[model samples]
Target: MPWLARSRPLFPAALLTASWWGKVLEGGRAAPRNGRCVMAPVRAVVRLRRRVCLQRKRRVLGPPAGPEAAVAAGAPGPGGGSPGQPRFFTFDDPAALPARTPRKRRRRSRVVLYPDGARRCRPRAERRSSRAQRCLLLLVAIVGFQVLNAIENLDDNAQRYDLDGLEKALQRAVFGQPAAVARIVALLRDYLATHVHSRPLLLALLGPSGVGKSHVGRLLAGHFGAVLEDRSLVLQYHAGHHCPEARAVQLCGDELERSVADVVARAEAEEKTPLVLLDQVELMPGALLDRVLGLLQPQRPHPFQNAIYVLLSGAGGAEVTRFVLQNVTRAAPGETQDEAHAGPRAHQTDMELRAGLRALLAGAHPLWQAAAIVPFLLLDRHSVVSCFQEEMAGEGFFPEQARAERLAAQLSYYRVAGHEFAVTGCKQVVAKVNLL
Candidate 1:
């Protein structure tokens, strides 16, 4: 009776029916025990009747609010039972559902108070100290000073020998032999870089007679003449001109020895490296080559040690000609056009050529073993035309290209690989220009 007081007024019939069931279940009585009212064993069954009465009351009225509202308004729960199945206070009842409560995350606090923004973090320490920075600066300064000194020293040495002028003059005078000119300049640069020397520098200009070997010899003599400020310091001896076949061999040897002795003595006194140009050395006697080789030895006088000897010989002319012909015949189009891409191949070819010439000449004369061999290649048709034009201009002509080409066409050439190479080179250019 006390629990029936909670029954809704809108569901009087359901409440009354459920109350009758609750009374039957409880036997409608609370027994007196030890002078106190006590609940009967059927108290649980009475509570179940009350819950069922509530559910019936909810169905008669509108659905409850919140999670229970969906349970009341929606269809029956899963595992819908038959009419004979037990229906008292099962989880399938719509009014028994509980409301959902989301779980809370266990997050830590991120915010904190700081006295000052600038000092909020520990200051990052430098990897190096002030003393280390000073040492690094001092090292940089010393390295820079050393590099500058080396560069200045190189420039002074090069200027002392006038290498720049010599390279330029050789380039202007010599054509179709860029490798030869470059090697010659590089050798001179290396040798003249320092005043001290272990032995003399002997550069053998080996090529066929008209490939500007003599012209290069002349240019070197002229340039060194102005640089040394003493014509006596430059000795240019032509075997064919200075010592003819009619002259006694002993007389010629003595004359050459005396001239070299005087030049070397003067150069040593002046503390300079004299230039000795020996032209047509292929025609020179064996005794003369021995004498020249003696001067290049370490046991020679101090003056001999400080001199530069250039031997222009035609001994390797046949080899140089054969090498050029074979190259022209076998060379690919790319080999002639793309030099940068074919650098290794070209360098290999040069090494082979130098090796071949060295082997050939070294066998003939021991002096050539120590000499720097510069091989002059054959001149092309264009270089021959240029030479013709140059000779013409020197002879006070207009130096017309068409006229020069016409003159160049008269010369003989060895045609190979769709190109023409002058057989006589620029040797006959002077004679042809003089006739005009």
Candidate 2:
């Protein structure tokens, strides 16, 4: 051992320092020493000691003794991860160490944010606001729908107005059955629609008393957007009165006439439709009708020709009486009566009326003819009932069916020889009474 100890100093300094110098030195002493100083054996012992010390030192001073450390230590040698480690590493094998498994990540839950739960709930104020908005939208929709409907109705040609009321009023005046009244209405509507572009000149409504001629004329005026006036009304306007009067004036004032003229002038200037519905037109002098006829005549390219719709409502043959009285009354009663017997008298009267009508027609163009003349037949018994029923639909004052039957019966009684005249020459009689 002493001899081997002497060779301990020959061991590598790396082995001695890495493996703990004392332990490395002690292990080296096992080497044999010969009298001849065998350097080969000593060198071999030194090499082994140096390798052991290096490994021991690396294990002690390197990373901690964990899986990571083992992996780092067991990593590929100087070349790479192949078969084995250095021969010196055979003494220390830590390859049995377990590997580290990856850690599982925890998930965080999400939080929902609701600022005001009360508002989210159906609060009274919110509900009220929503309801109000809905109602406003509904109202707007309704108004828009109504406007569109009105425009469409105005454009429709197939649409018809309620004529039952008119028929009842004219049941006595019409000359035919109630059913004929429908045809009259259709004709009247067609005429008005076609003649909207014409002016008033010699327009006349020839029918008997109680016929709806005056009434229909008024309605036509309304349709034309006309301002209407009668003889009395005209006289009132001439009396310097701005409003209608209940009575007529005995004396005609020039100033009042001028005022009436002003009104007419203003009506003309304001671009309004002027229509005079003379109910008792026969009362007026023949000269007046003649003048009216002259005005009614369609004028070619005449300015303000469309501004008037002369509405003369009179009983048939009434014009003849007025014509005679008007001219005869102007002369001495005896002289006028004597002239009335002359053949020239009837010729003159006919010429005069024709002249007036001709003058009016002259002013009116062909376009005005359709609208200017509306000769209507009166309603019959059944028409009277139908008209009454229509009127009853509104005012809850009467039973529609019963009232219509009663009116029809009364109208039937009034017709002579089973024939009735239309009240208004404007519309035809649709209802007829079969007395049998």
Over 46-165, each residue of candidate 2 has an lDDT whose tens digit, in order, gives: 555555665765655653354465446554443454343432243344555443344467988887566864445565766665778889999999999999886675545223323344
Clashing residue pairs, backbone N/CA/C < 3 A, model 1: none
Q: Weakest 10 consecutive residues, lDDT, candidate 2?
A: 235-244
Best by lDDT: 1
Question: lDDT for each of the candidates?
Answer: 0.78, 0.43
> What's the CA error at residue 28 for candidate 1, in Å?
62
lDDT score at residue 129, model 1, on the 0-100 scale: 64
Candidate 1 residues 340-374, lDDT tens each?
Answer: 21355656667788899999988888989999888
Positional deviation of 318 in candidate 2, in angstroms? 9.2
